[model samples]
Target chain A: MSSGKHYAKGSPKPVLPDDGQLRLFSMRFCPYAHRAHLVLKAKKVPHHTVYINLSEKPEWLVDVSPLLKVPALQLSAEKGQPSLIESLIIAEYLDEKYPQNPLLPKDPLKKAQEKILLERFSGVSSAFYKIFLQSSGLDDFSLALDIFEQELAKRGTPFFGGDKPGYVDYMIWPWLERLPLVEFALKDYKFDAKRFAKIAKLIELLKADDVVKSFYVTPEQHIEFWKSRRAGNANYDLLA
Target chain B: MSSGKHYAKGSPKPVLPDDGQLRLFSMRFCPYAHRAHLVLKAKKVPHHTVYINLSEKPEWLVDVSPLLKVPALQLSAEKGQPSLIESLIIAEYLDEKYPQNPLLPKDPLKKAQEKILLERFSGVSSAFYKIFLQSSGLDDFSLALDIFEQELAKRGTPFFGGDKPGYVDYMIWPWLERLPLVEFALKDYKFDAKRFAKIAKLIELLKADDVVKSFYVTPEQHIEFWKSRRAGNANYDLLA
Candidate 1:
């Protein structure tokens, strides 16, 4: 299954204007945008994704996005109704906006515990992003990955939510999906599954997921896209 | 109004041992810790606070806090009950844990909007913290405050949550409470009340609030504490 429409490098944006029923501004290959994709898939939230050309951003997108980032939801086309930015907020919004299949636990303590996990997981997210973005991972990176794997083991839950994937699972799943890309690029940084059995199991569970299968791209594809991004022109079809 | 039990500089650790009731590990001057305090106060939650000396962070705090940060709540003294860190998470937990009075908006959209505000507000919080911590006012620091003020104005509410202070109010109030100290320290970086009238009014309202008044500290007191912390001592009398 296609994650969303791809506005590949050197391609023109769709000329058809938005019809205004909950549209997500996204870039097909963006991990952050992919987060929104996973949440929508998990919650089965009905929405459309309009892939933006990051290299050559449309003027309108700049108006909607305060920071010019993807995964911005155009709340309403009405005048002065500002778009919502940030992936986690957007994900939780979708969960709240549509209650059909709740991703978040209704119990407050459980929810807070999950939020704490998301906060702690930021270290892992930063490390994953930095290794590729700054090309430096010799420090403040490995320690975070260690904490994550240890926490997963300590929890003894197959998934962060246990038995079935829940808020915590969906929140971090996108990044775990992209870890292989990091390993492929940095020879020293390898994902040792045996060392991190629980994470490995979680990753395996996520890959076999129907929603994950729809947009799963291998490390080579991710690496291809990264090369294009590094060379100044992105939107390469890693999954093509 | 007392915020919580303070472990003053050079003071002995409390003689009373841990009893299972919810206990907050906090630092009086820390804005993040203050957020948790505000939530507990707002919800009228019956919990105890144990102010930690961040400078000399006790071994027990380090043991429980993975990041060695305060605002850690000991949910239980049981062997494996990992302490919860992060103020927003703690604040939300208190809201969920004790449901006497709900601090969060019932509506999901409202909650998401509040969270988006929190995410955006981080810029302001960072700038405020950095100007004091690094002793610099140059760069993205001021722009964030401007956006915050502008957003407050755009909302057109006396408080972020109309009619009364809500989740957004408590989450960001701690930082706002410290703005005066920022202004006192950085002569050039002042909070122009006329420009940020909504915030100004919010500040006044918060000051008059019974709960806020109880823990309110003077800018002079904050400056004194800052001088100690800056000189690497800390534990000055903000409450006194």
Candidate 2:
């Protein structure tokens, strides 16, 4: 995992030789990057992490990620070697390449079902984004949570991926991890754990999972990060 | 391919027995659904097409597709059987299930690269949507096209998938197919073919490809559909 401060614009470019080791360009507080982190930890993929200052992006990032986004997985450290971007795509690629502790289902239909669940989870994410930006959308977030609760009951599984925290569980984890911080931001926000018993249980289960625990951040820390972001001078190196 | 009008609200529910034959719930004029059509045609996948009215969706669509979106591939005709939604997911599912005439690459890295290209194509799609709605965004569309032109030149492949049109080609074709209609909608928009010579040639190649030819719509026909859509009555049955 990445340690130390984020490399911002004008920071000396780190040496990235073709060492055959995987490198992940990431940001500590980014949920999307967090998704990749969980996948790598779960799979035990050998990779190094490089933090980037998103606000003042470095010039060299475009070589690896044309879109200049985080969670870009560099397969080789060689300059001009293209890196994979998009959290889902990066996770899928890692799973495919590593082929151990598989994140996705092998059966095509079953895999599609898992992906569909993730698609529905987008509603929750949209609501989360709304709340993050404007401190609203709790109603919509609750409605989205209802869908998850129903799906969990129908599946009758411990995790969304069945018995273990797999792709869907991990993909959705980053957002769930920050819910407390979101609740802190909102006035009189109380998550009805009883209504969403299954999801609530799943959240607790994920919190205890080995992979999640290693990369997990506390609600207090998240709130601190949120404060920094809201203050217009995001402290990307809070834990560095 | 479907041969009749779309099923709208108040329409009788079609019998969906537990037949093994694949069914694609699609709309005639939808670009996203058009993507699935091209893939099915290219792969020679034996599938039935059922057109749905977007404005007045049938009640039964919810059973097959929870999201009620087009290009929902029903693996079985049985009621309550879930169908796949989202064009890219459906396409990926089809490719994985069939495993013949593969739309994606075998190498995981290569596949990621192709997928990344598609990610970049989102710029063009966003611009296209702008023009479709307000008859603007030609400049942005051209700028997005420049990226495609560069990528095509860098790859030096006849198509994005090399030698033959594949997933990315088919996925992007729907937008390209409607570009002419977009041009017609604008006052004095002329596509600079020379600037995007490679993409221009690619458009021609895709136009002539057997699968694409089978599902081709002329610029004039697209203009008619656009006119209907702009008038608040989409002519989904134009070809029917």
Candidate 3:
């Protein structure tokens, strides 16, 4: 479950070895890819990662990823390393394949609830893209954030899944982890921390992973990454 | 397990029974809702359905579906008939609850493959919306359809999950069912049957369900419903 070592973006993808190891294809700052990293970390699944340059994608990625997106899990099977794309499906795949520390609840209904939460959180990502790309629609996102806060109040659970941070938490946290960067870019824009107490607390717990040694990027770096992408020339080597 | 009865569109919703019974909230012509109807049929789940007037959404639906969309499943339990919304989530809930005749493949990797297939098919829906709404861009949709056909060919499976139709087949079948309707709206547009032979076969299997007595509406009816909606006065009672 150790944080996957960073493979320099634009580096050639390593050969699909017969060693039978689960490999993840991702970019350092992509939240969708981060979802896979969080699930792998939470489940303590031993795996490796190959960072892809979105601007200059490797041809090999398409062989595995039908859509050529990251967070594609290349399973180490005797038959061959078949790749699985889409973070939600990959997360579910990890949960099902490695049953030792389950990310989803044991109860079917509760598990369904976790998935619904993931669906509900889609608005936040949409808001993020709209704000970052078009530089509009911040207020619309706040409505979704408010609903999320209300849901937390209604549940009265420390995390979405009672005491533990289940799939929903990990699924949502990847984006929330980068919200600070959004705030930095969009001045005078911030979450009402007091109103979103649970979220604020969750962010705090998520902050420990921001240390330089940690697997994921820090909020400060994310802001720079956004600035680079906005210029139409993404600086993938900012942290290199 | 039995097929759910369809409610007349535009009719008032039936009283929610206190007795436990799975009820589906849907619109007869809605392809998204049709996804759930197909799953319920495949699983043979004995559920009731309330056809909603999407144009005139009921207040009660908002209580269950935050987005006020249909394909919401209300599960009768001792506590209450808790409702689940969104076609995919509700479909998963149904699959999880009714273990018999599983919609998804049993193997984790196979299950992941099915989900990725569903995700890949999403472009078809988006392309459908773009072409239908903007009244242009048929070629792009054909490319997506081409990928889908190629996928079925590559796998050499009767269905996306192999053999009998499963979740992927049901989830995607709804949109493909409407492609012909789109073709009706836009001339010189048709799925290449020879290219998509597997899909042509699936359509043959799907047509029997298109009989007047089936719970869902036929593709011909879908074209009429779409025409009605386009004119800004939907004829929900077209089938009636």
Candidate 4:
């Protein structure tokens, strides 16, 4: 599954031509785009990534995405208009259209549970993102992390869905992966990464898996990107 | 459908026992709770409403609803357990168990559309709710209404779905009915209610229909209640 599109370290970037293939317009540093990438990787769905510079969005990118946000996917085939933006909607659409490894459980109750967890994650992430934006004091950061740790503690198993990584895990992991960057931003924040044992274990498990590891990037890169973003030295056009 | 339960004008209140037949702990004014109310009425599902005062939530209410919010529903028939929380989940549960006057459309795409609209309405309502809470002047209110008007304009028909009102309509209409209260609060600020023509027209259409009007209250009363709420004079608990 990984052989066809392997990127050698420092290799020339892959050209994602508009040849009616599935083209994912994304910024590598974005958690949202990373979410889409994870889903495609887990499902083994082939797609071309067009890295959009967030500071200076390309005319074609804006033309394709009304929201002009990264993680915007264009599914162009031999016929019909290319399907456009919104990450969650696109992920669900892909899950429905291509039924390889099911992301959502079949039972309605189980599916509802997954959705609830996703909603909680969204709420938690929003709070954390706000704190990150303001470079708010450590007290707020610790409080937000404590809430997340408490939520992670409620799950029966290591993963949100108990055993196999499901929709909630995919939706949530990207943000969790970016937490180190957040921690770097607020150096005074006192939350120990190990305090969230379930999350730590889940991250370890996911990183160890071959399919998951393919999409994983080091924490150092994440911290560097965010630091540059906060300094206003880096253009964030890809995320716009 | 309206026979069993009567809120007759100028009559002594009926001796409604907390025998708990079915306890719906809700704030009557909440759009989310209104969704449950519309379904219960449509199905004629008999339940006694327990208005949970949000500001000073009783101990039992907190025990029943950890979130300490209204729209919590409990079935007295089932000995003792936690009541169901979250409006959309409760609506689905009712539709599944009762199966009368199904709220959801049968077709998959149509169901998807309802869910999308419901989500959109929620997003819009959340934005407006924030503006209503934090706005010191009319500018914020006008901006929020402008966004709401644009979203309403995107709808192809009077109802979010075509002719008949469905789940999305019930989910959204209650909130729109309450918008005037926000407007009243910003009255001195010179906010223009006339600018929201489409929303006003839709509310009028909803209020005139037999099915919708069955549970509808006068706009003036709705506005008055919500205004009192903003002033912290009225108890929301009485509303459930």
* Candidate models: Cα lDDT each: 0.74, 0.87, 0.75, 0.65
Please provide, for model 3 over B127-218, each residue's C-alpha lDDT reduced to its tens digit, 9 standing for 90 to 100: 89888888776777877788878887888877766776668777887787777777876776776788778788776765654321265556
- Candidate 1's TM-score: 0.89
TM-score attained by model 4? 0.77
**Pairs with steric clashes in candidate 1:** B1-B214
Top candidate on lDDT is 2
Q: Summarize candidate 2's per-residue lDDT along B55-108 as a digit string, tens digits.
A: 999988888787788889988744455688888989998899888899999788
**Models sorted by lDDT, best on top:** 2, 3, 1, 4
Give TM-scores of chain A for all candidates: 0.86, 0.95, 0.89, 0.82
Cα lDDT tens digits, model 2, A1-240, are 455589998887787555678999999999999999999999998888899998899888887777799989887844566688999999998889889999899988889888888988888989998987898998899999899899989999999889998899999999999989768868688778999899999999999999999888999999898898889988899889
Please give, as one word, the docking class of candidate 1: medium
Better lDDT candidate (1, 4): 1
Name the top DockQ candidate. 2
True contacts kept of 2: 0.79
Candidate 2 vs. truth: CA RMSD? 1.8
TM-score of 3: 0.91
Model 4 C-alpha lDDT per residue in residues A1-240, reported as the tens digit of each score:
112332322435455555666778777777888788878877888877777667656655655566577777776662443545556766666676668888977554455545644655556577677768877644554555565567668766777656778787788778777777666766766447577676777888877866667777678867666778788865433222
- The alpha-carbon lDDT assigned to residue A178 of candidate 3 equals 81
lDDT-superior candidate, 3 or 4: 3
Ranking by DockQ: 2, 3, 1, 4
